[model samples]
Target: MVTVKAVVAGSFGGPEVLALVDAPDPVAGAGEVVVTVEASGVGYVDIMARRGEYGPLSVPGFTPGVEIAGVVTEVGEGVDGGWLGRRVFSQVQGGGYAQKVLVGADSLATVPEGVGAGEAVAIGVNGLVARIGLERAGVGRGDSVVVRGARGGIGLMAVQQAAALGAEVTAVVSRGRPDDRLEEFGASRVVPSAEAGASAEYDVVLDTVGGAEVGAWVSRLRPNGRFVLCGAAGGAPDTAFGEALLENYHKSPTFIAFSLGSLPGPAIVPQAQVLFEAAAAGRLRGVVQEVLPLAQAHQAHRLVEGGGLFGKVVLTP
Candidate 1:
């Protein structure tokens, strides 16, 4: 009998709820493929889902991971046999915290030659979010952009992508000195979170951390500026930022809440391909802060929740 090992969340609460367990192996169904997972990423979103904060993933008994990279080992009916040995990565609804995972065949992205499985998951998923958010906000050369939570994975990518596009990027860290690498990553200036909304007006603000500060940042938007919310690791805004948003309505300020899930599967394939090639060419950088065994998923969750990591924490099954 075939069995699969996975980290299961028997109940939603803290990291303690996650346990490594064995289950009957899953088989690929029509339009699905089974991937032998190499590395999975742990992020603030996983922490939120584990704590029942994320509505769609609040259910118990589910494995909590979305960023996955692996080799395709099995294909379902109608799937191309060429996928049997391809290295791939994807973002799924759940079940990535396992030795193998079943995913839709259409969702797979080929991993480039030079990118490791860990780097694929780290850069692929976060970079996709950053790229899409920046594009949606119409950021371009010479735009003044502020990226909140710029030291973490997605924020770090946002900083790099915006700068690469010629935007004058300001990276806002939660506290303390910003990493020197953030500047190297293309941040023109590094500011503490408290200071990001102080004086400077920006053409675009990409917010990953949400709080009362969102209101302040909205007030700092220049005419025709865009404020894009990609994630809210700091918790949702409790302030009445709408009034501030309305104050700039005549100036044509744009507020956009972006989520990668809103996109179709086909939309990600080309983007992933570009990202993989960029990483391969050293144009894109991914930081894998730590790699832990699958059984230590609880520890991985704790580390992500505790914050201050410059990159991503990966779990190898």
Candidate 2:
């Protein structure tokens, strides 16, 4: 009957519906480890989950959070005893908003020395998403890539990763701070949402902001290019499928959708390990705009929904 503090949703609604509640402490089941969370990332999907927009996978009154970084406090049966007391990060299935969380052993990535918990949490979701999207898009040295929503957590990571990979990045940002931060993230060019229509074509387009903008940019891909759709921050619009088809008929540019949830548990840890190494080598960096205690989970959600933060928001307990 051990208990822990967690943010819970009694109903599917807005950020206000999140409440601090006492819940039974999580324990490591077989092949799992119980962690004392030092930080949990607050992502766009968390907001969508709170509103019940994710459909079948959604649950009511569940603790919401997808990524956490902390120290392993206990190991379940059949797990390696060496994992005990190690600091790690996980791409959790859910329940990361609590002070303690259970994580599958297969999904754990050791946090490197000198990497803070907040940055590890950021790398857990947003970092992995960027890595997968860029790899899928086949971006390489001297390739030109376009990134929509370039100021967001994932988008900024994409910009930095693309640059580190030797690709020229064109960042499409909203009218204000987003534009400025995109440049800071190493985008070679920055364009406002309105002007993206006339920008130079790219070898690949990493679109985090889907909507009419997606349809517009799909037409901007060069011959044999790729377009990776990773988020819907710009709003999901009815895509002009016919137009998209017509625009790429000759080049045969590919369109791929990406979600970290689609990956197998075992695959994520290795991918996260690569990102951690990149961050440790200074080839990748995570921006964490704010870190608040678990009691401020509601406020953190509000800030995320309102937008304009230059980095990831994290909750700690």
Candidate 3:
């Protein structure tokens, strides 16, 4: 029987739970295509899922990856033959941490001709999350924006994208980190987290690290300012805190908590198209900090948990 290699979480707990193992080959159903995974994305969500902190959707002992870049190797019945051998980026529910994955035909986005597999995965999920979050926040020219966790995958992209839109971005990051790139990424100001909420005035705040710290920023937002909570790298706040935030910050401030997964699959293609065009035009900067072999996934997870990485970590199978 055909088989493939994947990183399986044998049990939920820590990075040690991940193990590279052989599994049965997956076949494409109708309207799906099987892809040979060239690059699989490793992100915060993977770590959360592996620790059983991702709630009901992500079960233990499952392959965990949300996006991948690869070439189509086989097409299911009713799939277009032209897709064979074509390079594509796929958004999957899970199971992307394998040598081969079955992808929905419509969920596939053509990787730009000059883009490498790892780069595609970088701009695929992280890029879209940043772009869509900024869009939902209604960022515009001359708007003051603060991107929490600016060193992260999505935050880095969002900082640059917001700057490209003429918004003045302030990147909030940990102290003593490699932050010299914030200016290059179009950030006008870089504030350490210890002193972030002191400024207390911004048109928008795109937050990746959520918790009581995120709630503290509520008082910093100006009237009608938008606070977009796109991730909870520090653990999410509970409903009581959320309600209290709204009640205390009654200046008509808007709190938007969303994920890229909540959007429809077809919305992905168009958004991916825009990101690819931006990168091609040099409007957006690189997101991939490094790419490692798939076997090093456990190490990658450890690095992510340590929270010192400069950008997205990808695994090549």
Candidate 4:
């Protein structure tokens, strides 16, 4: 069997659990294609997997990356021969931190011309989460939207996408020196999370960093405004559902949870394709802060957990 180098989690713990090892090159089964990956996204979900927060590790030595950009090397049974040499990006369910990965042909999004591999990887999960969350929250022209964790990968994308849609964007970032990248992404204003109460009332709230802030921000929305909760990076808080409902119904606001895993597969593919086009057109901005080799996957995780990076991190094999 031909083997490929990959980052595998030997156990559920911390970044130290991620090990670089040689694994058999994944084969393209029927209706699938094998890609020779140039870059893979290192995201919060990967960190969660490393800490065993999402669920039990499916395999002891399983690869953990969920998104990759690569060139198709082979097509499986029932797949078109034309796809064999195409450059594509995919949101794989797993097994992406390898020199090669197998994915369903239907899941592959063709990378647009002139888009760099690192940019494509940066747009992976973060872009999808932002697109879905903002759309679900009904963000559009003249609307005011608040984005929690504005300096984060998904948060930055949400800020850009919302602004492009003509919404007034208020970015709520952790207290510190402001991130110039947030303004570059089109945020109308940046405020410390502690000062979030001072932000103008918004039509929509994209809460990528959940916790006490959820309740505080939920109370800040205008009547009938929508709040989309995307991540718990700030730490999930135990809020009283009764109080939340009272605030929603009495205040005419709506609360919706956003997760790519919960959405229908067909729904996600088209959105991803749109993002790829937007990236190619220069309308979408994806900040890639670091690109580390596959052997340094553990260090990459540590950086992600340490939480000051302003953009996506790509792991190259």
lDDT of 3 by residue, 27-68 (tens): 989999999999999999888888887763367779989999
The true-versus-predicted C-alpha distance at residue 190 of model 3, in Å, is 1.2
Task: List lDDT for all candidates, in order.
Answer: 0.90, 0.86, 0.85, 0.85
Write one digit per residue (lDDT tens) for candidate 2, span 1-317: 87999999879998889999999988789999999999999998888889898653388889999899999999999999999989999987778999999889988999888788999987779988988999998889999998887878998889998998999998877666335557777898888777766657889989887877677677888999899999876567455944885867898889898988888778888889888888888777888999999989899999988876778999999
Clash-forming residue pairs, model 1: none
Mark the 10 consecutive residues where model 2 has the least summed lDDT. Answer: 174-183
Worst 10 residues of 1 by lDDT: 191-200
CA displacement after TM-score superposition, residue 289 of candidate 3 (Å) = 2.1
Q: Which candidate is the best by TM-score?
A: 1
Q: Considering only N, C-alpha and C atoms within 3 Å, which residue pairs clash in candidate 2? A: none
Q: Which stretches of candidate 3 lie over 4 Å from their true place?
A: 238-240, 243-250
Candidate closer to the true structure by lDDT (higher is better), 1 or 4: 1
Question: Which candidate gets the maximum lDDT versus the true structure?
Answer: 1
Alpha carbon lDDT of residue 94, candidate 2?
A: 73
Candidate 4 per-residue lDDT over residues 178-297, each given as its tens digit: 676688899999887766664468889898878775776777788888989898886775576437658567779888987787764445778888998998889997789898999999
Q: Please, what is the TM-score per model?
A: 0.97, 0.95, 0.95, 0.95
